[model samples]
Target: MNLSLQFNPELFRDPNRFCVYVHGLPEMPVAWVGFCRVADVLISPDAYASQAWRDTALTAPLISLTVTDVCETEGEAMRAALRLVRMYQPPINLRSGPVSSRSGRKVMCLETGVTYDTAAAAARANGLFESQLSVYLNRRSTGKIRGLTFKRV
Candidate 1:
């Protein structure tokens, strides 16, 4: 019931395809992510205590049991994931012609050194897998913006 959650997204070229972890997991540890009435972000208390989490899966998506509460569920996880996405949105500064309308090809125009987070990459709740949330908010501004053009990237 009690768990700790830590988000250490993979360091691969594409941070989206990251792994997740559920900390303080008993024989059967579960990573609960939904929105908790108490804390907006609750990770497993002992999830970060594991050497495996630090050494091996440090960057992997970790879920600590200590982050759980009386009202927690996958649904709430989705909500929290979405809420995080909204909160972590970066400033969009379109620079270039109308980009395409593809999925991955669609690139956003964030300031240099600014990148999306795990939760922001996840366009929706379904996109949030385990503890690693995908960030996709800074997507290029597409469509006619006050009578402008739109594209993917």
Candidate 2:
């Protein structure tokens, strides 16, 4: 989905990519507006205790943004995001725009809690899947959770 983020930056256009930070609602920085991008998010096996499937998907609870909506500056997006984190309680899955593309590089992933669903209707009719977005938070993960930035492996 092509969406407008709170803040548009030259760096975002770079293939190097950027990061989106999510926090607990109660722990939001201030007033946060939400954003969505198609960037690839990282997941770790011990993600929320190996709960990647639900956490990364729209099933996880809401989180706080780094910025607040009250702030209308360069980082206004960050401020808005922070406030959002403070507002929403989680187990809510939040997302940005669509996936960003690079010349020949596959985006790296860092997911933790991973769930699998083949039939969205069947999963939900059984009171299993929450929405048509077939997803769940039940799986075994042996993945790694990277830090905020990257380093040579």
Candidate 3:
């Protein structure tokens, strides 16, 4: 599917060749808005455990995405991440209203939790597939959480 994201047009022109970052809704740094091939980063369990996700544990009770979303195949997750980045903006606030993409894909932002499951659940409900959420989290797959283990916030 062609997400047709508008942030970095040239970089995403060829979705098959590059990796993209799209997770960390609450902590996604503004500086990460671009295309890159540095798909070597890994989001260790300890890395995803954040206060933001925990803060909304009771109210949100949702996930952002899942292991399945990013582990479908090689580079598939990257493509998904690019789709997310193209569709949404920074600091994904789960408490806000839904945002629509040019193609009419509406994604409800979620407060980032401390665990992968929570993040995935929230993102999955919004619009993202279980394919690329992990790529957005770690930049690359470490294959450590194939079973999708996460620490509860």
Candidate 4:
């Protein structure tokens, strides 16, 4: 989908109407879908103030938002959104629980040449937050921090 067309302000001008927005990568399965007032999706102080939603949906450059439907009432929009969710089977749906990228995987510390049973164990031993360790692991670099490097084994 063309981001230029999707982000067009004119498309989200209605304040009373609810819009169903799908968030996902191009050519990949839809990761998330939901309905909200058009104003909630727009970038403004009073609206689009959800840092959590923005962090999950907008932080990745490849992620796109497509307005699939618009409804006059919230119930209609919610039903439509539920229908889409059922059809797409998005893995990122709210009911699926949090997705952990490195929870169970073994992580090897390059500096110590020792492998921990899980990322959590490695992070605990290294005095790093699991989230911080996840960031390093997800980066394209060598997953280095404080002269130590780690990799999934």
Candidate 5:
């Protein structure tokens, strides 16, 4: 969705929904994809204007701030964003924070002995947050959370 300069933030008033922001063309060669609430970026003018890349792309005759998907939960939006990141492999997304690393990490459930091709896949199948899985993998601790143990494979 194209966001106009004077667009009303109320247009995306759902505080609970997660907004997926896409740079460049929505179809292909997406420069970046990140998810946040409307208040985080849209409602707050300072936050909205902080993304210099968005302004640069808009002035460069390219569409910026395309809202690709509005997910019910942050986890769902994250999963969708990770899927896009993997598919497009956009270079600029490395600056989008930790979510950018969800592309190709293999995760195995120590308790269930199930290995997932990607952290996103593991999170989706097990109904866990990808971020939580990342923490377990990064810490390399034997402790378990929610009775589930994970390790990077």
Candidate 6:
């Protein structure tokens, strides 16, 4: 028996929805799933490239996979998804808030030209999102900040 089968979410999303399939090795592909509105804040583990392939049929909750892990192996990618879900699930309360909350409105309070990959390290170092850039800017403090303009990337 496949023990991994128990961990499968069996979640599904519509085919027409905006989806991002971060390709990995030929044998492994990780699909980041969500609507366009919440493209920045939330994502779901919609599909994976296994020996057998399948697509989601209805939207499930956001799975919160990080951009940096986009290239990891299939197992690593899924573990990362579960880690992110455990990390961000409670306070953000994706299940309880209005649909708009998924748009990063309640979470991503700051914006910069910094791509997700650029600031991910700094954000992780600070134990927060890149929003700290705004804090540095507002204080007029000299910091390793970049992208002066503040709009969603």
Top candidate (TM-score): 5
**lDDT, candidates in the order shown:** 0.32, 0.28, 0.34, 0.36, 0.36, 0.26
Residues 1-153, candidate 4, lDDT per residue (tens digit)?
Answer: 111111111345665554444443333322333423333332344333455545645555565454445566544643454454334333222221222454543332333233334444544664554422221122234322211112221
lDDT of 1: 0.32
Q: Stretches of candidate 1 above 4 Å error?
A: 1-71, 89-131, 136-153
Error of 1 at 50 (Å): 25
What does candidate 3 score on TM? 0.21
Could you give the C-alpha RMSD of every candidate to the true structure, in order shown? 14.4, 16.1, 16.5, 16.0, 14.5, 16.6
lDDT of 6 at 125: 50
The residue-level lDDT of candidate 4 at 129 comes to 43
In the range 1-153, model 5's lDDT, one tens digit per residue, is: 221111112236665654444434333221333433333332334534556644554455444444435567644654554454344332212112222243544332333243344434534554444433221221124322211212221
Off by over 4 Å in 4: 1-14, 25-65, 90-153
Expressed as tens digits, the lDDT of each residue in 1-153 for candidate 2 is 000112222235442333333323232222122343324333333542344433443343444223212222323434334333323224233323222242221122213322222222334443431211222222124222210111111
Q: Answer with 3 or 4, whichever has the higher lDDT.
A: 4
How well is each residue in 1-153 modelled by candidate 1, as lDDT tens digits? Answer: 222222333433544322222343333222224433433224445754566644533343332333322213333443443343333343334333333444323223333322232223332333333233233332235321111111111
Flag regions of model 5 displaced more than 4 Å. Answer: 1-11, 25-65, 89-153
Off by over 4 Å in 3: 1-24, 27-29, 32-123, 133-153
Q: How does model 3 fare in lDDT?
A: 0.34
Q: What's the true lDDT of residue 1 in model 6?
A: 6
| TM-scores, all models, native as reference | 0.21, 0.21, 0.21, 0.27, 0.28, 0.17
Q: Give the local distance difference test score of model 6.
A: 0.26
Which lDDT value does model 3 have at 78?
32
* Model 2 root mean square deviation, Cα atoms: 16.1
